[model samples]
Target: MLKKEEVKKVVRPEAPQYVKDVVEHPPFRVTTNTTLETLASYLRKFPIDVVPVFKSIFSEDVAGVVYPHTSLLIKSKKLDAKIGDFLNPPIVVKESWKIENVAEILIAESKWGAVVVDEEGKYVGIVTLRGLLSALALKEPKAKSVAAIYTPLGEKKSRAGFVKAIERVSKIFKKLVGGEVDGYVVLSRENGAVGILTIWDFVKSRRWYRGAGEPRPLFGTRVTRGESKHTGVVRVWRIMFRGVAVATPETPVEEVAKYMATTGLYVVPVVDKDQRVIGAVTVWDILHAYLYGPKEGREDIEVRKAIEIVVEKPTLETAIGIRPSKHVTGLRARDVMLTDIPSVNIRDTLSRIRKVFLRSRSSIVAVLDDGGKIVGFITRRDFLTYIAEKSLGYWKRQKGKMLILKEQVAPGETVRILVEEGTAGDIMKTNYPVVAPNTTVEEIAYKMLAAGTDYVVIVGEDNTPIGVVTKDELIKAFKERGRKAKVGELMTPAEIATVNFFASLHSVIKKINAYELDGVVVTEGNDIKGVVSVDDLALRPIEETLRGEKIIFFTKSGVLRKVSTGLRRLRYSKVGTLMAFDVMRPVSLNISINNDVGEIIDKLLENGVLPVFDEQGRLVGVLNKMDIVKDLARVYITYAMPEKVAEVKEMEREIKQS
Candidate 1:
């Protein structure tokens, strides 16, 4: 007879518990044939991120899953698309699956959550990252404690002052680098109350810049400032996100972690008994302190490797060997094609084309002739390539031509390079990929990968352009299933390119153009704080500026008026006096690398980009929609259709010989 302690260790120590034992039963689902509109309604009405799709009303089997963003993307173009048309690869796990094994699969697959099914393949319940984290939080060591893990504000607490410009606070972040804190608790400039300031707050405060030599939007109209007034200044209060989540020195580590996870904030400021801002503790610190203990130094484990270690419970089988029963068929081109295609006219300017891409949140655009026929296609890559190879020379030549004796500037004055502008016709590629509405998903997949293009024009039988099949659309059509790519495979690693929130707006824009990226992850030294997109750069609000200042006085009659200080101040008032913080949406969505390609697509459809992080809560990379389309297209061609490709090549050879 074994003792109770020995029995407990033998039964549950090696392999903790099963996911089914801890899954939440969300009372919302739709059948396989649910209408797109109905699915959209359910998604909007429910708090669930994804609605599970069942095989039938009577069956317990889950056919697939649909998310709000995926539905919205489809309805924006194909209003008739069914829930079945956009179902993600079903991520069903056995009820007996160990929690560690289940978490491994979820992370490896890049899933938002998993649907736990019984031995009979009946849908039992769901387990999301929140649930997983909650479970993991319970396991955190409580003995060695919060004070050992958190960094004390110490002397810096008193340094938190008001009236500091953004430039000054940025210097504080630089000094606090690698000190266990990523943000500071700010003291109000006027009231002496404690506030919070992070690097992301600074990024959100960036003024809108619409390229050089373009008029900025004022009130509602575009206005150009005369040559004399250009004052560039960013004040601190303008950029910092005002509210702060605070913790007391004596609070438990588990309590802080729970708060951080719930709010999706990485750092929390610690306050004294009277609620004075003291120091802070970052997610990076808590993860290191709580998980590995204070003795262990931070290590850069590959996200997958990290998941395998932290979630290293004894498993009966590996995830790759787990074969699912269902197969996806009847997926059509029209079902996933984008009909709300952005088109550029031959007469459209370069600036206009740029705006279209920015507005559509797409990289490629079709250029149409007067007859509404697709003549060419333009991509950011094509324009940038052309600009890189020829624009410099063109500008130099144009400047040489424009500069004569009278037009020549004084010694100290720099000559403005006259860049030669062209119409959309100049840069658009004439050899655009084309496909018909009935084109098989495999055919478009192969062609997209082969051509290295993100889109193909979908035309009618009469050769009239109807819609565009983009990589995003094709990825949605494929329904990331058996042997699909992982989020790690598609994400742009943070180390290769990243932007700090403290980086100037000009610097960030330059990095975007330089890297040809839609956005860059805003980091506080390897820990991702948020992301800044090019689209976020336009139409941001600004309040105070060195260029000019306007005071909005409110009357007792409930009227607000903008009164300028003077013409000199208004004229010299900087272009960006106040910046809009909402442009940089918080980094709310994240998936582990083990998560699937379909999960990445769902997030991409929702946020235009998906942030990838490790199990340790550090942001690793971001997966753009184009990244999903281009990369998955290759994976589909390589693994999904290798045998079919060989057979087709053989048939083509035989026909040629005949």
Candidate 2:
């Protein structure tokens, strides 16, 4: 076992320095008297997200601000209106304030920009969220592995589950006190791909709900009939955006940080060579690294020991058979291919297609035929570009008449009208990038860059979409495999927690909660088949439950039952119709018990959990990232044993005498 002192003595290379000593962009001043046309022109000319609006140009004090959305509202209302009408109070931060604190305030307010003031209360500059991210990117954490910080998909998938998961993650994020993660990643059991569900996507979905005349406690108003109304159930699968950027263990922190800054991503999943999600890297993680460096010490031995005891002896791992691997090899695309890739039926609606795009969080998604064969594809930019161009063209053609029409149109109706302007077929591409399962990481990267896209479909011999690999996945996979240390010393030794494939979903949920586990292994007798968790439940929603319709079903004993009005019974209805086998995620990867410790840590950091197997290929134990952390902190070992300390002192004295 590696000693704490030895581990601490291993000096990490210093991160890239932050060169800029001051905020890059100074706050451009605008006045309340500034015309909407002038503000719009300024926005078009400048690469800024916001500008300070003051009572007068001569006044040094900022009155409020004008942003993109505010500009839109101004244009939609009165083009001649003054900027003051739409001004919102600015979130001002002192120049000396920690960037992390600034980030927290901005995130909470959903504001894109904050005014950085000097000690004398003079406006010095503006700090947009992206700017802070960019600045942080300059001094990112020393890259050890992406898995060290990536948040797991955990046991979350339903709307309620999503809400709870977000809340839970938010709480964890708050504790970071340096930066925040803005979204959650879901490894969809339904689709068999690692996907993203962002807070902004949720915000958009909330708007859709409000547009459908549903009462949302969070967003209190309803849209009028002229706008599109999305009345379907809001499932995680329907609204999640697809595709994610990923990083490997060896990838530099600067690379991940720069990507997040440029792309506005808050988190990036870390994957091994095989493309399995082992862990994730987030802005907060980077911030922590930036502020505190890698944490190690003999200083909080009690706290470390307490954590080790609690996490090392987890009841969930004890119930589930999981273990660590002995060796990690360079993996091919086949290792990460998602067998249950999501595809839209040819007959599906634009609404349905839109939902799929949101669910995948991918700019591009597969379109299928009636026979479930691949046909074409749809992309985010295609529809979005079409909408903006069409809207502008229509407004320009109408000229004066359009301005009148806009004045007459209700505020809620705007989005609906815009949505009605296009359909799935309008923006879908028939020819998209595709790759085979055996493709290497280098080849995949070359293909993606050559095709000028971040995502590609993985196909089997039959030319059907088996899975997908994104730009992020390729970037992360580039990190080479690691070695040193053994799995037995690193992995958590536990009996696998599992449920039969035929078990009810409710039973699965109950079991997971009872055991306080993220997921449970699905088994057929003594053989492990797959895994099931809360995310599966969140992704799979029963139609009857959403519609609140009466569902009559027969029990296995031939008994008849009717479920009406209540969601629990409705969920139970789904359970009666489908088994755990219906929602279980296929097990594609596991580590050997004799694998190198470095390989085990890499796996745990990136994958969240490691399924340990014995030499005979039998499942043995499971090791989670937390378990590794505890072990690293020397929580399980007695601190500063008296005999060992005395022996160390004697040895030191002998050396000194010599």
Candidate 3:
């Protein structure tokens, strides 16, 4: 018979872990030119504590780093400025460095983590405090439960007043030395953990109060203050994240650390079987354990070969010869098509079509014939074009070309009435792209790009619509494949269209129409000031017209008057005068042409388009949703089904021949 300790050791074997085992790809990296607003948007989406900044995409030189807390501290107006203007020098370490040494450096520097580089001095990945904790937890399986490491929320602290209690909790988080904690949980007598709050919530609330047009606060409570008052009290219940995840006291420390590492959530509240709050486990506590806990049997492993860091998990699988399921080569249009279509009769009034667009929340509305067969389609762009033309016509009919009117020339209601009089067929695009239900998703994607559209309608045997495939569906498919292709391989190479910052709105509209572009970059000399898109120019006016708001015009008499006229006042306005700096998303939202396409798919889906730059920071091409869809289709045909390559080529030839 073996002794108990000897038997336990035989049952579970221990292996040494290294920093390379725990390092992961950073969520996203930004260039020094990235703006605070764009950084904030990325932080809001991923909730990562630190963001790495590179000198340029072409090199591995570290510029600096941006913290979420630092981003929140800047005024909203200054968000348009470049991040390089306000950054902390980055702390870098070798990939082979010991985890314990890295932890000491992070604590001593009072930083989140250091950027990891390969022996060749090239960027590889990041090793965070959270990652170290996770490695430690895995190395010590027999370690104590979460209760041993959690910070107890005593009865008195749990029952304290909302604001006062939060202040105290914030102080406790501030005193931690190793890892940073930005999240806190609220406990109530009835509910074990009522809600969770992070530093993000407070910053978001500030933006809302400053009228930056941020989304309403998550907490349903509103803050009211006098004109002279600088502060307002807010109830804790209104601002906390009510659906926060919790861990039981008896849960394994490794389990909690694994959850934090996977989700980027650094804090978890501990509860008892009765659902009463006991304590909380944070990233700092996990770090403390790894730094001071038992290391009796643990050892560090040596890394011989350099490991290639992949930012996406699925990409790593692809690197190892495991193709994702969506790229199985048998997916057809029917497999990924959206069956619930929004449609209207060809003869339906424009008013009816508008209502359908608003209700369905769709960008495209199918136009059907009398027999319920698809004939054409109406897009939001079409409506915008109609309004712009009508407004221009009404302006042209008036005698004054540049005169500021003192009174109403035509009631704003006239444009609205005229717009509603046309039928869907009057503005519907007849050259809409169509596809067969059995067509491969790749082929569908190709047709969309060749036709210069974002979607393709799937037809049945009789040429009637069965379903539709859009860029969104293709994005999902591409995300699953986890291809390692670079953005330069898929982006549409074109000279960037630009307009002077001082140009009039009339010139801006002309440039857009002439180039058939959705937007143009605004520049001063060679520097990019901002971007003005179709949404800013056309959609905004249409929304104002629909809302029955009076258009303000300043007459030569120097008095501002509310006129019920058409869009004549806006036609001659300077772009700089009317354009909102915040509307300039491209100021900081660009990607390197050499970056992996998988890293920017989400950004393309969100912005509809992105500006691609070379190593020299010069705009080389534009990568839009259509470009990605086309590439996905091409990849699918090339790898998944090689036999279809010739067929796709012939289709391309036919499209070009026509």
lDDT of 1: 0.50
Mark the regions of model 1 whose C-alpha exceeds 4 Å error after superposition: 1-330, 340-342, 354-365, 379-417, 460-464, 478-519, 522-524, 532-588, 594-602, 639-658
lDDT of 2 at 628: 34
Q: Candidate 1 on 163-238: residue-level lDDT in tens?
A: 2333454345442322223345555432222345543333222231211233446688655565424343334555
Please provide, for model 2 over 573-656, each residue's C-alpha lDDT reduced to its tens digit, 9 standing for 90 to 100.
211123565456556567787876554445444334456788988877665433333232221112322343355457667989
**Distance from true location, Cα of 221 in model 1, Å:** 30
lDDT leaderboard ranking: 3, 1, 2
TM-score of 3: 0.37
- TM-score of each predicted structure versus truth: 0.36, 0.31, 0.37
Which parts of model 3 are misplaced by more than 4 Å?
Answer: 1-330, 345-359, 368-375, 393-421, 497-499, 502-518, 534-538, 542-590, 614-618, 632-658
Error of 3 at 302 (Å): 69
Against the reference, the lDDT scores of all candidates come to 0.50, 0.47, 0.56
Relative to the true structure, candidate 2 reaches a TM of 0.31
Clashing pairs for predicted structure model 3, backbone only: 219-238
Q: How many pairs collide in each candidate, listed in order? A: 20, 46, 1
Write down the RMSD of all candidates, one decimal each.
30.5, 22.0, 26.3
